[model samples]
Structure formats: structure tokens, C-alpha cells
Target: MAKLISLFFGNAFILAYALDESTNQVEAINLKDISLPITLDSLQTKETIYPIPAMICFDDRIFYGQEVRTHKKFFSPHTFLYMKQYIAKNQHLPRIIGDQEISNFQAAEILMISIIHRIEEIYGAENISMYVFPVPPKGFEIFAQWIEKFCFRIGLVSFKIVDGGVCSLLAYGLGHELGTNFMYINFGPMCLDLYILKVEESSNEPRLRSVLLGGLNKNYGSIDIHKSLRDELIDYNITVRKAAEIVHHLINNQTFEEEINGQQLHFSRTQLHELLNRKGYGQELKNILADLIDLASGIGVTYESVQYVLCAGSSLQVPYYRNILKDFFGYKLLYNKAHNCPAARWSGIPSASGQWQYHQGQLRAPQPDSKGRRL
Candidate 1:
């Protein structure tokens, strides 16, 4: 069945989901279709409003869109939620790496509410029937009561909030036609979730059966690689930290050019593209690759059942990162596709990092977070 999928980002949330067969895919909906706006009282409401039609899918489980939009000014996308403590020290640099540590309760409730609101906006509340398949982080049971309370309030009285990685497996399973025996890895800013999914095709509709999922806390993300590259430059007194910061910002959007310190330093995306294409930075690129290899080795899945790798997020778009993985793992191993969104399309795939991601303690980062804080 065709469904209206909406992607939402704002506040501290990120959520996405597909509508079921019972729901109609409306290009437009009636104003009288919605219940009173969530924020407004029934007594104060005059009529209903319709929401937009958009497909929703998520890898990180936290709701994006409205929650992120509402809190955008304060939110830095690359930082890990659990590592907020490191934000203050690294805030000076254009790029800062930190893990976002949030209670599962907060993660689930806020995300559900945000998704419900976003769905209401697109299809109108009355017409929208959503099934939230939230990917639970490790130790999800701690948030059980919170999930129960959230379900009761959101009208998802009979919905499911499964593990985010498993949900991703479902999405990836459909996209890749993955059979019962493949594994799925979801690499995000805060953690990496790996799952061994067995699809039970015994029924007419394939179902995710007998899933083994786990979350790893090595926690090397896009910003960590950026910082590592910056440190490599600092060792030579090149001090391209500013440039590195701009590049990090550019990966997400092309607005960083306007924020350059001076016209001499004012580099556009085209110029940055050229910089990556130039021949002088081969060593720097190698250093970045070494870091990623180390990260994979530490994770113990470097040579595991990694048949197809999916790379996403702003980090993987960097030529420095892509070339290294391509050179070492071969062209097919790199998921840098021309037709893809470059960022979103590469989501959940493994790429490279610095010493922090390495296999052994011997290849540790030479210049640690000046403050010795590990990402």
C-alpha cells in the first residue's frame, strides 16, 4: 500500500515512520480532518488543519525535524549526545565532538510526540494512523515505564517501539532484499548498533525473526575524524583547524562559505571541492584512513560478515575519508555513489576513522583531545 511518509526534525527529536495499508496516501487533506492542535485547547480551537505528505525513516531513533528545528540553535548535529561534557572544551573549534547522553525515557517520549505532531501536520490528525517503530538503544528496559506512558498519550495504544537497529534492518531488508541470514550495522554519532537479522519468509509477508542486536560504545563519529585531521595539521603548524571546521559544516549544508573569516579564507563549496581534489594532501588523507581502520579493528568486526557497506552522514562525503576506504577496501567497498544523496544515502554504512578507532593500543591518537577526552 502506498503511504505518506513524513520526516520530522526539531527540538531534541528525530523521528520517521511509514503509514500502514489502512491509511490512505493523500496528496492533500481536509482542514476539518485534524483534532485541535496539540498545543491548543479544544475550547480555543476553531477548526482542523492538514499536515504535509512525507516518507519517514530513521537510523538514530531520536526524533529529528520539529524537535531538532525547535532546538536547532542549540543543537549541533555531529556531536554525540552522551559526550556533551566535552562540548565546552571543543566549542572553540569549528567542529566539536561529543556524545549525546539522554535518558531512554526522554528519547522515546519526545520522539513519539514529535512524530505524532509531524504526522498530524501532513495528513491531519484524524486521517493519520502511524505505527512508531523506535530503535531502542542498549539497556532499553530502563525506559520501559516511560515508553508505556508515551504510548498511552500518543494514541499509539497498540503500536510498537522496537529497537532502532531492528527497524533499520526492516528498512534495509526491504531496500536490499536482504534474506534471513544477513547482518545490519547502524553507525551513528553516539554509537554503532549491529544486528544479525533472520528474515522469516515462511509467511507471505517477510518478517524480521530471531534478531541479535548490540550497541557498541567506542563512539567515534564524524567530528572525531575531523578533530583528528585538525590535530594532524596542527602538528605541522599548518593550523587548518578553521578550514577543517568549515569543511565539517559544509558537509551538512553549503552555508559555511558565508561564515569565513576573510575574503582570503572565504572558500566556497566549489573551491573546497577543488582542495579535496588537489594532490598535496595525500599524506593527510592517509592519516584519516589509518584512524578509521583502527576504529574498525577495535570494534572487532573489521573482517566480519561485512559484505555490503553503507556510508552516510556528512562525514563520509569527504574525499579524504572516501578515497582512503576506497583505496584500502577497493572501489566496490566504498559506497560513494553518484546518484545517492551523498549524505543520507550512505547512512548506517561503516567508513574509516583515526587511531581511536584502531585495533590496538599501539596505534593510539598521537595528539589526544588536548584535554585527554576520548570520543
Candidate 2:
């Protein structure tokens, strides 16, 4: 176990360097007068642990940073339009079996692969061996088959599918500094992941124990919410979609310094709360938010037996949501400040005890290290 942990951490460093180098390459190209240093620093700080160069699209706006940058540079506007069409045609259907459908997985994989292909074009496909961990909801077989077909279509010959919540658990286990019980909550599109973690019972030494998995209420992930918002505003409906989109745009674009309705609208942190607090739309918006909160609470109640919750996700970017969690779960509830993509390059070594052996074809017993350590 220790060896495996060490190997992963070592790889994390190498991946970090490669990602940093790619960001520098992008920084070399000057666009929008954005300085290389600022971009470099931003990328370095925001995505130190991500394994490869990828694009992260939240809502309609895209974030192109060092580790997870959008592929806006390579594709034309028409290309994006086609891509959106393909996504909608294939993915926008509701599933009868599980929380998601085949189309849903395909859409996500296509987007992720698009980012991967963009990075490979820059860094050479020979060096890019990627893995994806898509969180699975109840009744995952249907979606799994869909993902398998999508992987084949995308030419991803070698890949692995892990439960998204489990991947987060793997990261959290590896990231533990002290032997204290911890809880992880991953809020994604479709569902939320709740995991209860503690030290194992058998081992005298501290290590991650069995996980108790639960899910919170279901809704479209941040991406879905953002898209809904954009659609509503485009249609001039002051619905949940519009409110969500406005908040999403401001957070990602940061230059929320736009003039709308002949009034200068500075979408600072308080924009969501302020907008929701307004007269007519407030009630409806509050209801939507309340539904999301209820979902979270429902999931929390399933694990209500446990305390110490840590929230992580793109949606957590909203301050109001965090406040809601704190109020509902009490002060003991916390948020994860780690980069959103912790699974790809998570660090921290776990200690595993066993014998090691290296052979030409088969292995024997575990060998001792220089310090006479067996594992």
C-alpha cells in the first residue's frame, strides 16, 4: 500500500511539471493582452494537481487555465455550434433506468475527450495516457455500457471506469494528514456523493476504513444549471436558469463589470443573494434553491449518523450554498478548498504492509528495502 501511494505521489509531481510546461506554451501566445506571468501564476495556483491539460466548461462560459483550460483556441465558432448540437441531440434525454442515460455519459466523455485531444495535439498523443473517473448513480450498468461505446468511438483504447465518489474517497484517504474521521461530499450534476471515512478496524496503524456511501438530491450539475440559466436569459425568462446563469457567468468571467438593462451591473459575490432577494423573482428562486438544499439535506440525513462534512465541487463556488450547508449542517460542516480536479494527481502516501518480490515472469515474496522495510 505504501509503495502504491509513493508511486502515485511521485507521478503527481511529474504530471504537475508537464501541465505547468503546457501552460507556459499557451502563455507564449499573447491574446487579449493577458500577460504570460499572470496567466502562468493563475494556472499554477488554480491547477497544481491536475494530471493533464483539459478544458473545464461551467455553464456556457469556459475556463481555460493551465491544467484545465478550454479548447476555444483550436476550434472555430461554427465548430463549437456543431459540438453543442451534437451534445444536445445525443445527451439531453431523460433516463428511465438510472439517474443518467447513455446520452449523458456520451456528452460528458465527448467534452472531456475534446479537451484531451486538444492537449494531445500540443503535447503529442504518444505521451498522453489518460484515465477518467465518472461518478456513477444508482443503476450504473446502462450508463457504463454507454460510456464503453463512447470510449470506443473516441478511440480511447485503454481506460478505466471508477465510481466518481470512490475516486474522491481514494484521494481523501491518500490526502489524510492525521488519523481523524472525515466525510466527503461531492456535489455534481445529477447527484451528490456523501462518504463517511474513518480508520480501518483491523490494522493497529491508522488507515482509511470502509466507506458508507450515500447521495443527496438530484439535479442538473453546475453545467446543466448554467446552461439552463443561459437559455432562460436568452429567452428573456427570469427563471431559475437565468438566475443561475448570471451567477455562473460572473464567477467564471470575473469581469462581471457589464452593463445590462442600461444599468451598470457589478456582479460581485453578493449578486446571487441580491438578485434572489428581489421582489417577484425572489420567491421562485428561493424555491429552486430550497429544492437543492432539500436534496442536500436528504443525502445528509442518510448519513446523518455521521458528522464532519467536507464539501467539494464547481457548484460550491457559490457562497450562498456554502452558507446554507453551514446553517443546515452546523459549524462542524466544512468545505474543500482543494482544486476541483484532485483525483488525477492527488498526493499523500499510504502505508501498506506486505512482502515484495520481483521475478522474470512471476513474483515471489516482498523484499526488504535499504532500511530493512518489507513494505
Candidate 3:
């Protein structure tokens, strides 16, 4: 029988899977070394007529592994990255990145086309009967309209669009528990999405969560970590690449430094913590906690119903935010780890912060209600 494919449209990358013949069973996944890019070739003619606006590369090719901070000479003309957060967005696209003018629809189409291309390459076009894609929070209606166009353009006959946070729940494998609710907080380059999931009582299947909040921090994320550090280190004239290396060293080791042009730039874990605290990120962490409490309470999230807090993002893996999450969720804090789910891949986050999705704890899926089932 032909296989069913599920496309994971991440904030910075695109990953997909082929389902088993059995009902809703995921047989295979890839977690590492499959981070794909989104690009559009300005050189390409409109008459070329792609299934979508963007492809893995519209009119050119891209090779990863060596880090390229700025697209400049390294990337092709018209190629773009970090556009996933803008798909289905109501606002105009952000000012050109890498001298590329990208529409939200184009970005999403490029990403979708890229994933579909990979799927077709792997399983053959005729083998794919349907697709399962998760939509960003606050983008259900827009995504629906966009996806309708997407399916028509791509000739996808059937598919399902669920909350992206719910994909976190599925990817992390929430256990089945009665009266327990799962809270997932994901930080992407463009925004942070929060999803609160509750299982149905009758079928024990996870359903649409009551707590669905997104775009919590539109202009903040792991990128801010790099930008803030790079800007601060600029006082001593450290290069962006060196600053990125220093940031990486801080995440893995206790202290680190580099000599650039015979100038010593170094910082220990103490300085790292202090820097974050001095910067607005520490306050951003606090703001996140406070908002969680307020939103949880406002949405009727009680200790009785709320069971666990799952942090699923490369940005959240940082000890800085993990410590705060620990304080808020305590033992209930479950994180996503790269080791646990080998079949997974970074959900389109940039390499700067996205690669740090080391390991996070896990939780049990909530028990569904006893009436009509929603999975």
C-alpha cells in the first residue's frame, strides 16, 4: 500500500515522515543532520512555474555544514531564511533579509514544496495518499486558506492540520492520564507558542487544548541571545562569528574565550549568567513565567487539571531558561531531548540556537473524555 506522509513545517527547517500501513503509526523519523533551508531564486523567471514559490532552492543550490552568518556572497541571490515565522502572517514581510523580498505565502510555499519534494523523492509521488501538517497558533484560519491553495497547487488530495504545539506533544509522546493537562511552550525565531492539551475522557486521545497562545514575544528568541551577545562583545571588537563561538562554548562548557587579532575576549559561566541577567532576557524569562501563570489561571489551569509543563525548543534547552522553568514547573517540567527521539529533527530553527536542542524530559499523554473523540 502507498504510504502516508506527515510534513513537519518548523520555524527554521522542514522535516517529514512516512507513516506505516497500520492506523496512524509513525514508523520512521530523522532527528539529526537533516536541517533543510528555505530559499527563493530571484534569477528564476515567473514562467518557470514551481508548485510553490520557494523550493529547497528556487533557481540555485545550497550546501550546509559550514556556518554562514550572513547570506551575502555565501548564499545565492534571492534566497531567504528564517521566513517560516512569517507564513500566514497578516503584516507585510519584514524588510529584506539577504536582499530578498519574500512574501509570507511564498516562504510557506517554498518550505512546503521543499518538504514535498523530499517526500516524493523518498516514497514516490503516487505513494503519498495524504499529508499531516501542524499549523502555528493564531494562524488556524489563515493557514487553512493558505493550505487550501497549497493542496490545490501541489495536488494533495487529503491532509490534516493541527496545532504545531500538539506536534510537540506527539513528537515528545505525552502519556495517557486522566484529568491531567499538558502545557507546551515552544520558542521559535519569530515567536513563542504555548499550547495546553487535554485528553478526551472517552477515547483517551489528546484534543485541541484550551490554552493556545502564540506570538508571545514577536521580536525575541534564541536569535536575541546571539545578537545581544554579539552587540555587547562588540565593545571589545569581537566579530560576530567569534561571538557565536563564544556563545556555543558557554552552552557546552563553563567558561570560554577567543583571541581575535591578538585581542583576548573571554567570559566565564558567572559572566554569562550576569550578562543574561543584565540583558532583558532574564526579565523576558520572568515575563514568560508571569504570563504563564496569568494565562494558565485565566484559562482555568489549576493544579488539579494541570499536570506537567513540557519545554520543546532549542532555545529552552539553555540552562538559563531551564532554571526558570524548573522553578515554575518544578518536577513537572519535561523537556525534549535529541537523544530520546532520534527520528526527529529541529523544527526549522536556525543553527545558531536550534542546534542546541540537546535533551528535555518527557511526560504522559492525557486521558481523553468519555464522549466523542478528538485526536
Per-model tally of clashing residue pairs = 54, 9, 25
Largest TM-score belongs to which candidate? 3
lDDT of 2 by residue, 136-249 (tens): 333334444555566567766444333333345455443333344446665543334444444333232112233343333333234444444445345343544445657766
Candidate 1 vs 2: which has more lDDT: 2
- The window of 10 residues in a row where model 1 has the poorest summed lDDT is 48-57
All candidates: TM-score? 0.42, 0.46, 0.58
Which ten contiguous residues of candidate 2 have the minimum total lDDT?
A: 3-12
User: What are the Cα lDDT values of the candidates?
Assistant: 0.37, 0.38, 0.50
lDDT of 2 at 321: 58
Sequence-dependent TM-score of model 3: 0.58
Better of 2 and 3 by TM-score: 3
